[model samples]
Target chain A: MITIKKPGLLSTIQDLGRYGYQKYGVVVSGVMDSFSFRIANLLVGNEENTPAIEMTIVGPSIQFHQDSLIAICGGDLSPSIDGQTISMWRPIFVKKDSTLQFGESINGARAYLAVAGGIVVPYVMGSASTYVRGKLGGLLGRALQSGDQVEIGNLTELSKKVMDHLHTNGPAKWFVPFYKPINPIIRMLKGHEFDLFTDASKNLLINETFTITKEADRMGYRLSGPKLMQKEQKDMLSAAVSLGTIQITPDGSPIILLADRQTTGGYPKIAQVISVDLPLLAQMKPMDQVRFQMVTLEEAQHLFRKNETYLTDIKRAIKLKYR
Target chain B: MDLQFYPLGDQAVILEFGNIINPTIHKQIQVVSNYIEENPPDWMIEFTTAFTTITVFYNPEVLFYKEVCQELSHLLKNIKWDEPNEYRMIEIPVCYGGDFGPDLIEVAKTNGLTTDEVIDIHAKGEYIVYMIGFAPGFPYLGGMSEKIATPRKATPRLKIPARSVGIAGTQTGVYPIETPGGWQLIGKTPLELFLPNQEVPSLLRAGDRVHFTPISLDQYMEMEQTRS
Candidate 1:
């Protein structure tokens, strides 16, 4: 069991996302940075889609009520256990009643914490992700409150082995590296309305830097940089929208839809941030500047396949180590 | 007709049938959607429809973009658009005017018509569900009478009760959930528009036709009582 001592700005349980419900207009609310969420699970010997605590810009202070093995991934929220700084991408053993706290974030905007077993929350539509707007999933269909007591699910064989190893004073230097883009540039594929924008606007989108505005949230990142006007003003029919779709509003500002975005939108989409680049965009904070680069559909597919292959290899290596 | 397939992202592609909103365009969208729903591709994750476009989301890890587009194009060519309708025309019980509809009087005054005339014109129109969006099970309906048409409220209310049947511009829809909206409410429906726990959460679907049957407030209360 885990008890939240002080719930930070925004903290909720999330997995990959709720699937098979967008046709019914249910938002697939999940961790903002799924790449980090998956890695955090992997570090603790859990499945990639295991539910974890997704902390926002600020992180909550949690106390473990039972002995557990845990991993923290994504944004560097400067986590510490009993006043000692903890590593970000490694599993550590926490004794019963030990408290974990966080200071100011040093690198990114969101962090994920994974226990050996996933968070035990009743699933709504086959996902544990909390969709606050609809009050769909997670603990009572809302963010973790300060006094919330989260139960841990039963551990898998791998998790049980990992926990037993950690209990035996295992190697202290075990860690895995997460994907971190060297440049703050998100790659994208052209949208259906890509050609509708003026040539200058298209050029500016790829060359100029856009600042993430204060209106940024789990729903979307309203970017301020170029005024990308379409050649003609036409009312678009509302269509199914997904994560990382860069929609241009009537005022011409670009908004990148994120995890908690509406299932469908009527705005003209200019570009779609590639799946491989979503992690980079997910970590961006307000006032951070980012550039966009156009990539072919094949290139985007290739990058995603490479990432998946890496993930598969890591899982195999970890299994071999346990054996 | 030339079907233009465009990339929504790495995960989804949209097949656009036409550029405008018309019954024929909507029918085309429905035909494609129905075909895919009946014979779903292994790679297809989910598919949704709009006024004239059907966007198909897929698992990119399972199939490449080129293969998906090609498969869709081939399947579209073989689709027989002429099919007997399977969906039913559901009649919704609505209590128009008075306390159930706050904007009823204002809309009638703006359109230069009596409140009863406005209600009659709205209730008589044959409406079709074009899509579900904005909120869970909130239908974007088409085919409202132009005589009852009115602009949206200048300032949207923070809370519009669920099951409220409203109009905005040329379109009519039902608010499935309590949400902030700008639509001009003319009536309230007793039937639930959205049920979250069921296999099919939404009470309506794309291509379903709906008719509004006027009922007294007593009838509405009795129906609400039976529901609980």
Candidate 2:
């Protein structure tokens, strides 16, 4: 069990998100950075879909009541144990009664902490992800508060082996190198309504830089950039939107939909960020500048498959080391 | 049926039946959605249905983009459109006017009718659930009397209470959760449309038939108490 000493700015339990419920208007709320979340879970020998604590700019101060193996990934909020800074993207064994704290924004916007057995939360619609707006899953469908005691689930054979190895060896010498960038050029594919935009708007979309406005949250990031105008205003029937759909609002500013975006939208979307770059976009904070790069459908698919292969290789390497 | 396919992203594809929203297009979406729900492919993750389109999300690792398109095209041919159209008919009890519906007078005034006339017209109409979107269990209903149609409020309310029934343009819906919306509120429903604890969280689904029945405040209070 782990007790929350300080709940930070915003922290919630998340997995890969709740599926099979979008038809009912349920938003698929999950970790903002899937790449980091999956890596953190993998480092702790947990399944990639296992629930982990996702922290915003400010991270929670946690007190572990039992000996455990854990990994911290994604944004660097300067996590430390007993005043000593800890390494990320690698497993670390913490003794009982150790206090883990975070201070100062070092890099990125969100951080994920995964334990060996994953967080134990009652499944709502076959998921433990927190959809706060709907009050669906996670710990009572809300962010963590101070003094909240969360239980850990039983460890799998792989997790147990990893924990035992970590107990013998303080921390792994090797670590997965993750690129943390403040202003990133996000790659995207043309949306269904991409051709409907004016030529000037299409050119500006790829050439100009956009700043993430203060209105950014889990749902989406409202971008302040060159106004993108459609050739003609047409009434679009509401249709399903994806994780990285970039929708142009009535005011002409673009809003990139994220993890907690509504299943369907009526706005005309100009582009969809490729799967590989969604993690980079997720780590961006308010006021961060971003540029868009258009990629073909084939290129996007190729990149997605390459990323999966990289993750699969990492999993195999970790399993070999533990064995 | 004329079908068009577009790539939403690397992981999802949007199967658009037509550009316009009509009964024929809606039925086509329902047929495809029902078929996929009954026989979901291994590569398919899940899907979402809208007015004239059904977006199928899939695992890119399991199937390439071209393969996904091929599989869906093949599956579309096998859909059993001849199956009986068994839509669930649900009647919602609503208490109009007073504190429960703050914009009742405004809605009636916009429609050039009395509050009682507005309620009668709304209650008497038979509505169809076209799609559920925007908010969980929030039904996008069709088939409303144009006599009571009202434009959305210029400035949306920051917090519209849950279970508040409202009308916007030619559409009518019930807010299953509190959200910021521009729809003009005309009444409040006692039934809980979003049940998170249940296996099927949403009380309403696509292709369901819905109608509203006017109730007194006393009856509304009694039903609300029983539900709680």
Candidate 3:
């Protein structure tokens, strides 16, 4: 068990989240940086989809009720156990009664904390995720508050053996490398409303940079930069909207929908950011500059599959390390 | 009518039956949606339908951009559009006016009618479920008579209560969950339009017809108490 001494900014419990419920208007509100979430789980031998604490910018302070093992990933947030600074990628064994505190992130906005057997929050809609809009899921459907207690679920056999191994010696020498991120280039496919815009609007979108506004969240990012006018369409009937859908409102401002976006929308969508780049978007803060590039649907699909394959390879490598 | 298929993203393709919202086009979308659901390819993940089109998510490894479009076109060109309704009709009970509906008087005054006449006209119409969106299980209903054609609030409230029956433009619907909305609300329904706890939480689904029946304020209070 762990108790939150300080909830910190926007720290909430999340998992891989609910799928197949978009038809019912449920947005997938899981870990935004799934790449890091997967790494945290792999380090501790937890399932890739296990629930964990997703901290944005400022992480939390937690006092453990029992001795446990943990790993921190996503964003270069300086974390310390018992006031001793710890590395970001490596797993550490903490004795009972030790307090963990995380300071402001040096790079990126969100960090992930994965315990040995996932954070045990009661399931809602087949997921342990939090969708704070309708107050559904997570720890009573809200972000972590001070004095919240989270039970560690059934610890795996591998976790116990690893913990015991660490007790005799120390931390692992080399950690799984979360590759240094490259400058983002979001590849987009033409949206249904893509044809609604003039050719100049399309050209500018491909060439210009848009800044993320403070209004961004798990739902969508409101962007500013180009106010392109539509040539043909005025109002569009509401339709099925998904992650990476770039909607242009009547006023011509752009909103890039993300994990917690509504299932459907009425705004004209100019482009959809590809699936491979959506994880990067979840980490972006207000005023983060982003540029769009056009990629054919075939090319976008190819990259998605390539990324999925890389993830599988990473998981295999981590398991081999322990063996 | 020939359907135009476009790319929503790399993962999804949308087959649009143009921009018109006639029942014939809606039925066409339903047919295409049903087909994709029944005969999915190796890479197809899920399909969501709305208005006059259906969007399909597929695994790019198995289906290419041109392949998905061609596959859909081939099937759509041959598929029959006319069919009997595939859904059941359900009735929802609502408590109109008073605290449940703060704008009931405002809507009635604009239409130059007594509040009783307004309520009678609204409850009497059997509304068609055009689609479910805006909020969970919140139905976008058609068939609201022009007698209740009221504009939306200039400034939308941050918190419109769940199960509130409201009208905007020529459309009337219920709010499934409390959300910021521009709809002019007249009453609240005791029934849960969408409950995440239940299987198929939305009380109204696409293609299902619904008629609102007026219930007493006492009954509304009793239902709320029981739910708690």
Candidate 4:
């Protein structure tokens, strides 16, 4: 068990998200960066959908009450143990009564911490993710606060072996894959209402750069960029919207839906960020500028599959090393 | 009935029946939704039904896009609407006017009718649940009396109580949770529209027929007590 000493910013336990509930208008709240979240889980021998703590810009200060193995992944949040700086993207053995602290983010916006065993939280509608608005799932359907005691589930054989080997403190030999984009260009596909926008609006989408505004949160990122006006203000019925959907509000600005977005919306969507580039978008902080690049549906699907294969290969290599 | 489908993204497809909101469109949506629910593909993760459209979400790793589209097309062609779908005629107890409905008098004044007359018209009209969205179990209802139709408030309230029956322009809906909304409140219901613990959280589905039966404050308290 680990107790939260300071719940720095937004810290919540999340898995892949609740499935089979969109018809009931339930939000699928999960980790912002699934790529990093999965890697952290893999490093600790946890399942893909194992619950982990997702920290935002600022990370929480935690005190471990029991010796355990853990992995920290995603944005470089400069984590330290008892004032000693620690490395990331690899498994580390934490002794009982050890304290973990984090400072300002060095690169990205979100960080995921995975223990040897997943966090033991009650599942609501098939997920452990906390949907704050609905008050369902996770640890009482809310973010972690100071004094919260989180229990860990039973660990796997691999996790137990790793923990036993690093009884005091040490890192594993298994390496972690890094995904860093050369340019801050997000690839997107034309949405259903793509043709409804004016030609100038369409051109502006690809030509200009958009800045993520302060209004951004788990729900969506309200961008301050080119005002994309539609040809006509047609009354559109509410329809299903997914994560990465770039919706143009009545004010003409774009809002990119994220992990906790509502199931349905009535806004006109111009583009949808490709699934492969969503992790990069997730790492972007407020005031970060991003350019959009048009990609075909085929290209998007190809990229998604390629990324998945990359992760699968990494998982296989890690298991081979442990064996 | 004809069905139109297009890709929403690489992961989901939006199947639309038509652009209008009517009983025929609702029936078509219901038929397709029921068929898919009864025989869902292995790759399909979930689907959301809205007014005149249903978006089908799937896992790309398990099934190819072309194959999914082909299978959906074949299913659409084979769907038979002759079998009658279950229609739930739910009677919702509402407390209109007074404190339960702050805007009831204003809506009546705007429509040039008395409060009792507005209540009578609203109660007599036949309504159907078009979709459940905006909030969990918050039904977007159709078929409200046009006479009492009013535009939404310019400024939305920060906290509208749950189960508040409201009207905004041509649409009438109930707030299943406390949320900021611009709808003009006409009455309040004691029933729980959305409960997370239930197997099916939402009380009303897309095709369910609904009727409002006016009740007093004392009756509302009695029903609330019985449920608690």
For all candidates, state DockQ relative to the true structure.
0.74, 0.85, 0.66, 0.76
Report model 1's interface C-alpha RMSD after superposition on the true interface residues. 1.0
- Can you tell me which runs of candidate 4 are displaced by over 4 Å? none
TM-score of model 4 (CA atoms): 0.98
Each candidate's interface RMSD: 1.0, 0.9, 1.6, 0.9
lDDT of 2 by residue, A200-258 (tens): 99999999999999999999999998999999998888889989999999889999999
Clash tally, candidates in order: 0, 0, 1, 0
lDDT of 3 by residue, B141-199 (tens): 88888998899999998999888999898889998888898988989888888888887
- Chain A TM-score compared with the true chain A, each model in order: 0.98, 0.99, 0.95, 0.97
Worst 10 residues of 3 chain A by lDDT: A176-185
Q: lDDT of all the models against the reference?
A: 0.88, 0.91, 0.82, 0.88
In Å, residue A229's CA in model 3 sits off its true spot by 1.9
List, residue by residue over A17-119, the lDDT tens digit for candidate 3. 7766666666667878888887888778788888999998888999988988899998877899888998878778888999999986787778999999889
Candidate 4 chain A worst ten-residue window by lDDT: A166-175
Task: Judge candidate 4 against the unseen true structure and give its global Cα lDDT, from 0 to 1.
Answer: 0.88
- Candidate 1 lDDT over A1-323, as tens digits, reads 99999999899999999877777788888989988888889878899999999999899999999888899999899999989899988888888999999998888999999998889998888889998888879999899999999998788888778778878966448788766654478999998889999899899899998999999998999999979999888888788888999999999999999999999998999999999889888898899999989999999988888888888887887777765
Among these predicted structures, which one has the highest DockQ?
2
lDDT of 1: 0.88
